[model samples]
Target: MTDILPLAQLGRRIMVTGPTNAGKSTLTVALADKLGVPAYHVDLFRHLPHTDWEPRPTEDFHALHAAAIAEPEWVMDGNYSEILPQRLARATGIVVVDAPLLSRYVRYFKRTLQRQRVGALEGGKDSIKWDMIHWLWHTRGTAEAHRKLASETGLPAVFCRDQRDVAALCAAWDLRLSLS
Candidate 1:
């Protein structure tokens, strides 16, 4: 099947996965709005809210992730590979946002400069860090892994190769985005 799936082909439980700064959260919110479902971010479950990006306990994160997936209809974003299998099993469809590594780096830098964004950690400040820069570089190939996972799982998936593709998909799906 083609990677660009029609809106009708997508089911209620949609999973959005991508590398850092790839706009997964933005698309997730947009999809949830279009589908009239709740939106969940894996990051929100991974880290404690109203904190300085501190991580929740591993067990706590797992519990939150599991509970969120148990919900019937939702758009969940993020690719915590450790819990991917569980999420994938519950997800009805997938959207993989893949952009060039350079673009991702640029976006990461730009996002850090912004005070607020769709995927920002709650009450956590955004700042440039060597670890994050290294992460963006190291996980450059995550998009391919996400695509392979979708194919192996036989889930209907829509792939966005760049910002242009994401824009086109949003347009085709008639998604009204809150943040550009």
Candidate 2:
């Protein structure tokens, strides 16, 4: 696996994957800022307003994703497994932000609370459904998924095993944010 920081410099199209609250958004935004690239967040499209995750139609989602990936330089972060191959085929670099399940639990709570303090989805309320946790529990650390992401992308892999891994990359690249 390669260090992620260098990938930011080399990759014109980047894909970042991880369970929610693993700093996927933060990294995507920061990398976009530093590199003067565009960040396409899948969640912003996956989730529809006020209907509780009423997913956009599959074709619609793919269309939107494809348009962004068609761009010569862009970054996207999310684990939309159904469209993994589409993303992988277009990715110039791939990153997986991994952490212990316990750590993910803690971060989820913290992030949920922070969202509550501020606001929820711009068009929806804060929702931390039991089903969401269940989904995370089942999906969070699937080795098969990671292997497939790496194998299909053919881009070198960068795995951030903990917060420190992300932090080190930020520091090394002189990024303005801290993983903390």
Candidate 3:
């Protein structure tokens, strides 16, 4: 039997992990607002703000990620797997967004074509790239790894498998979309 935990049960330090364009950031913000905790977007720590998807130095990004996890309460969004162990150690629960690959591709292209995307780095421009298309193609199987990690750590996990699942969860939690 599948166990689907309620949003409130995810606790204060929730880790929202998923492939790019899978709505992880949006869910993180909603969870944070519902829980009255800070929301952290891992992309912000990994990339320099106000730039065209430029990455920060590896050490600098690691430092920022460490600091964010050290916070007492937060809902973090992203799947930086290299440093995932440390984050998982501090996380109380996990939310894994497993939207369909077609949906992900559509979201990626739509965001890139739009003037301003919700999760794009502040002041960073969104653009379509062959590399990103390749990345999207390889996003498969990531949600399973995320779920396995949560299981190993004995942390409960909630999975949003599609837009309908997301909507149901949000409604059940009484969560309001901040910016959608």
Candidate 4:
């Protein structure tokens, strides 16, 4: 899954995806800030206002996302699941930030309490749902699922074990490129 690290060219369109609260947004923002690329958190256009997250219309959300990635450079993070194929076609690189289930659970709550200021979609409230939390672990990809993701993307995706792996990649970005 090292395909995500820059090779001959710096990626112009990058997709960051993982189970919920796996630091997808954090990494996307860091890369976007350093690379001067537009970053879109899929949840921003996905969830409804406040605590009720019924999600926006699929067609409308996909259209908006399509427009965002149509730019010369962009970073987007989320595991929309349904539209991954469409996203993969446009993604020059992909980062899959997978963390331990325990870690995710810990973060799930930390962020929940911080929701008043730091959690959830920027404009949306930090609403908690039992099912969503369950899905975070229960529905997350396994080894086979990950392999499928790699196959589907048809591109090497950098597999990050956790947040530290992400930070290391960002800090050693130039070194990785030189090796490539």
Clashes of each: 0, 0, 0, 1
Shift of residue 54 alpha carbon in model 3, Å: 0.7
Per-residue CA lDDT of model 3 for 39-102, tens digit only, reads: 9999899999888788999999999999999999999998887888899999999888878888
Error of 3 at 105 (Å): 0.8
TM-score of each: 0.94, 0.84, 0.92, 0.81
lDDT by residue (tens digit), candidate 2, 1-180: 244446544478878787766677777877777778997788766766565456778788878888888899987888777877788788888777777777877766776655532112455655567876787688776644674666565676677777788778777767665342
Per-model CA lDDT versus the true structure: 0.85, 0.70, 0.82, 0.68
For residues 1-180, could you state the per-residue lDDT of candidate 4 as single tens digits?
243456324377878777777777777777677677787888876765564566888888888777876777887888777777777788887777777777777777776666632225545656567987888768555534654585576665677776567657766663221100
> Which segments of model 2 are wrong by more than 4 Å?
1-5, 50-52, 116-121, 178-180
List where candidate 3 sits over 4 angstroms from the true fold: 178-180
In lDDT terms, which candidate is top?
1
| Model 3 poorest ten-residue lDDT run | 1-10
- Lowest-scoring 10 consecutive residues by lDDT in candidate 1? 1-10
What's the ranking of the predictions by lDDT, best on top?
A: 1, 3, 2, 4
Best by TM-score: 1
The digit string of per-residue lDDT tens for model 1 on 123-159 reads 8866788998999989988888877887788888888
Per-residue lDDT of 86 in model 2: 83
Once fitted onto the true fold, the runs of candidate 1 whose alpha carbons sit more than 4 angstroms away are 1-3
- The better candidate by lDDT, 1 or 2, is 1
